[model samples]
Target: MRSVAAVLVVLGAAGATGALAQTPAPASPVPALDERVVVTGTAAPVSAGAVGRTLAIVTADDLQRLPVASVTDALRLLPGVWVRQRGPFGSQTDISIRGASFGQTLVLIDGVRVNDPQTGHHNGDLPVALEDIARIELLAGAGSSLHGADAVGGVINIITRREASAPTARLAAGQYDLVQGAVAWRPATMGVFQGASASVDRSSGFAPARDFVHQQVRADFRFGRTTLAVSHLDKDFGAAGYYGPAPSQEWTTQTLVAARHQRPLTGAWSVTGDAWYRTHGDEFLYDPRVLGARANEHRTHVVGGGLRVGGRLSSSLRLTTGVEATGDWLRSWSLGDREEARVSGFGELEARVGRLLLYPSARVDAYTTFGSAFSPSLAVALPVRPRVKWRASVGKAFRVPTFTERFYTDPNHRANEALRPEQGWTADTGLDTYLGGTWVATVTGFVRRERDVIDWVRPDATVRWRTENIRDVRSHGFEAFARGQAGPLALGAQYTFTRVETDRLAGLSKYVDDYAPHGVGGDVSLALPWRLSTAARLEHRRPYGREAWTTVDLRVSRPIRRVTAFVEMANVGDAQYQEIRGVAMPGRWARAGITVK
Candidate 1:
């Protein structure tokens, strides 16, 4: 295994040079970003034009032009984000943000929490089809402040396509006989509007058990002051022997419905009410006898409302304040009759003076299944010079036990309802700088200390694993990012270093022995003068208990009239590696296709 890994690393490096030579010239410069929203961190709204984080804006043009088979492919351009694909098609994706555990990250779809209430580990199995996405916002940091709850590491908000003024249809065909199609339309009157979209995708086997089928639909309508949306996603995936057993097939289904109403109050105040319902299903197996048949199903019902009122305190100062209320109920079939619910209320305040902004927020979580607690956070951003800025934040966050951790039961795992909630405090300081007109750099360092950390514990080989809380674990990390445009070509790269440790471990002296470390990656894209574009990417990561590996990928495309043709190479050198342990991923593969925009 070590020899195979080494050979792939060398091959990946050599292929980078060859891929660059075959790429196109370069495209025009990325526009000076404006209209970028900063809803992920500070309590108040911050635009990309005002704040300095390693923010990368990918426009609709960028999304449409890429030769992407899935949404994860489009996210590769952002710094501090890495993806591991198990096969040629989008069977499984392991995305890590800022070297944080996958379960620590939170994913939101149009303000609705997509993270499974049973286990955070299943959040990445987003059912929404990639073709339905309008835009994606990636906030790479501990976003416990603005988002509340599960956003300990980062937040990924996916915005779905809304009602457009025109109708559109897209059809695509690719390698391995892959086929996909999408159609959408919108029609509206003075007080009534309706929009809908449907899409389907399928592919032949690239490796054993690598075939997949996906279908999705979204429908929305607006009448008067009320709006409603309903969406569905279904996928059947053959994971092959990647997860230790051949014919390891998994199927997933998701359904969502949301409704909202908005009304203007006195002066600048606006009151809004929102509610949503979600259902998810998952089925997977290793072998019929050893692993047995496992199926998990969950449903969530959420309702909430909030009021926001803002006005000018003075010419230079702006004051914005709001209060919100939310209630959520979760039910799981795998939990053996267990149920959970939470009701929360929050308040926030923001103030700005000169080139500085400060925000403070507080929340009170009242749970029906567990006890309640109060959480608070504070943040500040200041521009020291025209080209430099400094920002810092301090906050407190907590994580409640999931249903799978407290009530689920299996032959290999047992539930522990006595588990205590995990609590933590985190702080970070960062600086952003722009040099000349060709380079931008950002550096950030953060430290987090958590108590009552939860982990699955095993007493002996004969006993089933159970959830337990361990005391005193600390983690710290730093990230450096830079992007530059030399002439017509755009280049960018980022590096991350992290250390995590627990004091309760017996043999290991430090927690760093178990955490991810030394993550470095870079991505570059160029657009030629002849309407042809090309992009290349490289990722090198070495985590604890694993061998280091580097991956190279490329994409090339040309447009003729309204049709665009392109080819994508993933793991161009066919690196054999694992993002998740015990999973043996496939080697080099390519997909070629064309799309009508």
Candidate 2:
């Protein structure tokens, strides 16, 4: 694997030199940024330009232009967001933001929370198909004031496509005996709009016990002011060295059903509500070929619902209030049967005074097991001049311990029932500027102080890993990015510097201190003649007390009539690195695919 990666890196460098030197003729003008309605940071759907918080938006067109296989792949391009994957193609993925742990981040699908109560490890196991995603909204910084628990770091919301213009199908094959197929359709019905999509992906092991199969299906219905959606995902993969150093195999399944409705009550008032149900199952074996070899099975179910009423209270003021309830239950042989319920109430006020916009929000959650908690936040945005803005925000957030951390028991690890919830306070400020009618630049600084942070630690190699509430941690970071488009070419670059201060403990830890202190990334895309296009991405990361690594990826595609063919080379520099310690990532690999619309 090391030799292959080294060779690919050399080839990639040479190819990049030639590609950068040759410039094609100017093709067309760059399109304006899409001003879509985003709902992740606020109580109601509002234009991204009107929000005061730090946010990033990824559109469907951007997904199509990039060589990405999953939502995790697309998120890595954004600033302040980290995606750690144990395997390729969305296998065992975890997301973090602004130096937060995996459990501190929250994920949602169309306003419905999907974070599993059993563990944060499965939070990225989304049921929605990739082709059905319309857009992704990433809200950085504290969001617990609006999203309740598990929103201490940030929020990632995946919005599904409500309508499709035409039927589309895609087929792909690649190294390691990979095969993938997907189909999507939107049908016109009487007084209703309907859509459906399905996909399947399978690959043989790149190494021993590394094979995987993934399947997904989605269906949607819309009429007047009501919408319904259903989705299911099943994944079974060889978990070679996924958990600890043992060769393991695992299977996971997820199902979700959701409904949403909206209606105008009067001239300035509207009512909105949504309800969803989700269930997940997992089966794990230390060794797939050996029967009864330290096997474990677990199942979890979550049901939640929310109702809200919001509208313009006056010409320059808006108000929104809502109530939410969630119930979670787990049935397992090792973790036992446990259930918990939570109810929350939240409200937000948005007022505009001259050139400054003010937003204040608060939420109170009552847990069946741990009493009540309150979160509050305030944000302000001011347009100092045309095409320039200044924003600042301060908030408090908290995360409840997962079931696995509190009750699970195994040979190598044991849970701690006395663990307490994690809490933190976060503040940030930033400036955004637009230059030359084509370029946009942003700079931001943030600080977070956390108390009673939960982590798994051990004193020595002979002892079991136990969960504990460690000491206070202070994290601070600075981030900057510049992006622009001119004629047929678009380019962007970003950098981040983060530092962590924590009281030293006696032994090794799982996730409290592992982070990339210095990171740099960039992307470039060009349009050529004959309906051809190319894109390249570069990423570099330096972890504290660890070796640094860099990687490069390139993609080229051409469209003819209704068909588009593309080729992608990933990890061209095949750097010897691991997102998760001890898990060996694949080296350089290539794939080809065709899509028809």
Number of the predicted model whose TM-score against the real structure is largest: 2
Model 2 whole-model lDDT (C-alpha atoms): 0.82
Per-model root-mean-square deviation over C-alphas: 9.6, 9.5
Sliding window of 10 residues with minimal summed lDDT for model 1? 24-33
Query: Candidate 1, residue 46: CA error in Å?
Result: 2.9
Task: Tell me each candidate's TM-score.
Answer: 0.83, 0.92
Query: Tens digit of lDDT per residue, candidate 1, span 1-597?
Result: 223323433443343334334533223111232435645444445675354223444444445544455666666655566565564445666566665555556777776677766665456656555556676766665565456566655678776766464556667665566787777766554345477778787877666677888788888788678888888878787777654556677776777777777787666555666677777666766554555566455655455555545545555455555555555556666665555566666666656543455666777776777687677766665555445556666667777777777887878777788987777766666766666565767777766767777777664666677777765767778888876667657777888888776665532221123345778877777888898889887788787778988888788988888677778877788888876665666567676666664
Runs in model 2 with CA error above 4 Å?
A: 1-34, 188-193, 435-439
